[model samples]
Target: MLKHILISVISNDKPGVVEAIAETVSDNGGNWLESSLSQLAGKFAGVIRVSVSPEQQEQLQSALSQLIEHGIWIKTEHIDADSAPKSDTTNAYIHALGPDRSGIVRELSRALAQHKINMAYLETALTSMPYSGDPLFDATGQLELPEGVDIPQLHDILDEIANNLALDLSLSETPFE
Candidate 1:
């Protein structure tokens, strides 16, 4: 039998970091399934999902610890698919565009919180043009809505907030798979 493990790794940014981790898993006969890795503030951080046979679990942990001793911190957790929660919820994707300013995230998140929406992912980036003195910030967020909620009411609330914040906001319903 094979078991799934979710691993999170964090360490100083350097060459061959990913290679070293991948080699450790490959040497242990583990298959890497999914990962999201990025460099933030000069540090390398990542979350990876891998599968290994039950018999190889202990050896894999030992190998991971060895890597940690060499300066990379690793955390591993066993994921039981059967115990995962099921959701019959839907969601809407909200995209907002406006100049960089304070109170944008606060206002948007506050409104969503009041409606009991779950924010799954959020990304914001600020860009400045050479000729323009002001910077523009683009913000995108994915929000999960409860089943049987009125979307029109939600849109009205969002629009009201956006207008007050002087941002252009767009919302669309997306089915949760």
Candidate 2:
């Protein structure tokens, strides 16, 4: 039987970090399943889900511990697929484009909270051209909405806020994959 584990790793940003971590999993006979990795504020952080045979679990844990000794901190937890959150839950995606400002995230998140929506993913970037004095921000947010909520109503609310904020905003239903 394959044991599934969710592992989160945090370490100083450096070359070969991913390779070192992957080597540990490969050496322990774990199958790398899925991962989301990024570098933020000079630190490399990632979350990976892997599957390994029961016999290899201890080896995997030991390998991860060794990484900690080398300055990488890892946290691992066994996951029960049966208890994992279902993605079939309905959701929506909201994308906003406008001048970079301070209140965008706060206002949008407050709206989502009012509707009890869950944020699944959010990415924001500032786009600037050489010699340009101001920068524009593009942000995308994926939110999980209640099953029976009217999507049109949500879109209308977002539209109103976007217009008031002078932002070009769009909302669409994002199918669970």
Highest lDDT model number: 2
lDDT of 2 by residue, 1-177 (tens): 799989999999999889988999999999899899999889999999999999999899889879987788999999974655775567678788887788988888888888878888888878873577588878888888877777778888888879877789888776322
Query: Per-residue CA lDDT of candidate 1, range 1-177, in tens?
Result: 788888899999999889988999999978998888988889999999889999998899789878977678999999974544477677678888877789889999998888878887777778773578688777887888877777899889988988887788888775222
Clashes of 1: 0
RMSD of each: 3.2, 3.0
Cand. 1 Cα-lDDT: 0.84
TM-score of 2: 0.82
Best by TM-score: 2
TM-score, every prediction: 0.80, 0.82
Superpose all Cα atoms of candidate 2 onto the true structure and report the RMSD in Å to 1 decimal: 3.0
What are the clashing pairs of model 2?
none
Global lDDT of each model? 0.84, 0.85
**Which 10 residues in a row give candidate 2 its minimum summed lDDT?**
80-89
